[model samples]
Target: MKKLLLTAGISALLATSAVAQTIGVSVARFDDNGLTIMRNGMTDHVDTLDGVDLQVEDAQDDVARQLDQINNFVASGVDAIIVNAVDTNATDAMSVAAASAGIPLVYVNRQPINMDTLPDGQAFVASNEVESGTLAAFQMCQDLRAQGKSGGAQAYMLMGQLSNQAAVQRSKDFHDVIGMDMCNFITLIDEQTANWSRDEAQDMMTNWISSGEPFDAVFANNDEMAIGAIQAMKASGLSMEEIVVGGVDATADALVAMQAGELDVTVFQDLAGQGAGSIDTALKLAAGEEVDKTVFIPFKLVTPENVADFLN
Candidate 1:
């Protein structure tokens, strides 16, 4: 009977070992709030899987460092690889390395530049850039009109990292919206790249304020920049009601800002959902299963009326 019991235990151990799969993940940076939530989502999802393991590394916003991490993952024989690109334009090397090694590669959050030419067993999982900026900008436009600024309004834009695809696309989205006849009353005073840093955005806004450019609105590529601009504006004694502030990525802090009547509009990018979806796609590709080349999680518009829905 003891021998039979030992045999059963050995079989269980073998079964667990056979099902184990390791995924290597490289994130653009660990300091960003949005990326932090997405990374946590990946780890939390791994907890629910029986025998899956995730090895995550931070690239610290360096393109070369991110590529080296991918190479190391490949050398280590990880079952699959996930990358949150530091620079969307510099992802071709990463794709090539993974494809040459016949390992599945999945990009999360940031859209890769060589997306159309990606080798088989590769996919991208993230919220659509078109929707993220459009939702936020359109909401801001409407808010401006409601505040009796339909006649004329000037605004400043805060851009994220120029190398990021999301930043470029989102900036285009804002321009597209304001060009429409219905929203044309809004004019852009100036736009500057804050590189998605709160402190940098605060400084930029302060400089704009010093120029005495009477602006009615501020558009930011992300919530961090929006909050930074708010801080600068408030410090300069500009009332929240005087300007319409809009941003993308309805992070926890952004939501709190909206609740406090500081942020006028924001778009929910479902960053955590993208993280979970990337893991699922990577596992599928690793197992030789089929998946869409691009998997897009939808973006949602957030405003004071419905901000409570996302606070949790």
Candidate 2:
């Protein structure tokens, strides 16, 4: 009687096996609040799929450490690996290693080049960061132009460090749009690599403001840096309204500031979508399905118009 009952239970579970799949994700760091939210969103989304087993490992923004983490997942024979690269350049070797071991990798949020060319079944998913930068600049330009300034508007950019893709693409987009005008009406007074740290951005902004560069606006590569620049401004007795500031990666604080009119704009990169789509692609590959080579998450300029729709 016991054996018969066990067989019946197994049969019933088989009926639901279509809803069961385990996916392993390696997130970059827990300290980045944006990434944490995205990871949670991924979990919630995967949970709804039924019987989906999701395991996560944190890389802590260390390059070699992340590589080691992926290697461990490979050794454990995870069905698939989702990698949020710490640096755009750190994962090529590991991508090669994983491919050699027959593991599929879906690179998320940050793009890595030529990984698929090495024979690994590779897929990459992330936001369009170039458009992110361009949108921020474009919005700022429009605002400045509308403010009755006949001359070109001046901007100060607190750039992310060279180590990350966010830095690379955001910088390119910011400059590209400005250059589109032949740059006669725009002057970038100064730019510094803040390494995406709020404190560093604060210090840099303080020094720049103290120097009296006469900047009409501040542009930051990420929300953290934008907030830091705001702090520096406040410390220097400048109101948020006095100097227009904008950023990318629509974090909570930035959104609050934007709503309060303390920030000019922020580009919304849907971190949640990037996370879910990346993991979904990885799982599909593990199940013997083809995954797209690239996925682009749309980015939008978050102003008061659409800020309410995205603030949550």
Compose the digit string of candidate 1's lDDT tens values, residues 62-126.
99999999999999999999999999999999999999999999999999999999999999999
Runs of candidate 2 exceeding 4 Å displacement: 7-20, 115-120
Q: Count the backbone clashes (under 3 Å) in each candidate.
A: 0, 1
Instruction: Give all TM-scores, in the order shown.
Output: 0.97, 0.92
Each candidate: RMSD: 1.3, 2.2
TM-score attained by model 1: 0.97
> Which regions of candidate 1 deviate over 4 angstroms?
1-11
**How well is each residue in 256-281 modelled by candidate 2, as lDDT tens digits?**
98888888889988889888898778
